[model samples]
Target: MIRHIVLFKFKPGISWDDPRALEAEGMAAKVGGEVPDLQEWSTGRNISTRPIAYDFAVIGLLEDEAALDRYLVHPFHQEAIRRWREISEWVIADLEE
Candidate 1:
């Protein structure tokens, strides 16, 4: 299985209650249900106050690289990414497990 992980940092001065932030958060929260080849999906806001912490995270599992690729290009995924782009920056990691 491929474990796909993403970490997001909200833009400076943006609050979690902001409309755009809420929309992006909602999209990320629901993407797994709307996409295919996703074996598992989870996302959440960060509770840590440490400097190294990001504001949000997404952890998901796919069958393999091909499925991971499909998830990347899927419309629902793209839409979530688009919404996120407006309010944050993110990084990702993919691991074979």
Candidate 2:
């Protein structure tokens, strides 16, 4: 399996209540249901005020690298990524488990 983690930092001045932000967050959280290859998935807004904390995160597990690739190209996942790109910058890490 592969553990895929993504952390997002919203652009400065972007409000949490913004419709784009809400849609980006919701889309990320619901991606698991839309992408069949995802073994697990979760996403949420950060409650922390710490400067080092990202504004949002997505944690997911895929069956393997191929599954991870499929997830990346899946239309739903792409749509989520597109929404996020308009409002944030993000970092990602993938680990074999």
Candidate 3:
């Protein structure tokens, strides 16, 4: 399986309570159930108080590269990406497991 992880950093002045942030959070929460290729998925705000920690994260497990590719382009995922882009920048890592 492929383990896909994404970390998001909110832009300057953007907070968790921002409308755009809330929308992105809601969209991300729904992607797992909406996309068939995602075997496992979870997303949430960071609880760490330390500096340098990302504001949000997403972890998804897919059966293979093809499934990972499909999840990356899924409409629900795309919509979440669009919403996130409005409030933050992100980095991702994909690993084989």
Clashes of each: 0, 0, 0
Q: How far is candidate 1 from the true structure (C-alpha RMSD, Å)?
A: 0.7
Residue range 40-96, candidate 2, lDDT tens digits: 888887899998989999999999999999999999999999999999999999999
Among these predictions, the greatest lDDT belongs to: 1
Candidate 1: where is the Cα deviation over 4 Å? none
lDDT score at residue 49, model 3, on the 0-100 scale? 74
Rank list by lDDT: 1, 2, 3
**Cα lDDT of model 3 by residue, 1-97, tens digit:** 9999999999999997788888889899999899999889999999997889999999999999999888888888888898999899999999999
Task: Write out the backbone clash pairs for model 2.
Answer: none
Off by over 4 Å in 3: none
Candidate 1, pairs of clashing residues = none
Model-by-model lDDT, in order? 0.94, 0.92, 0.92
- lDDT at residue 32 of model 2 (Cα atoms): 86
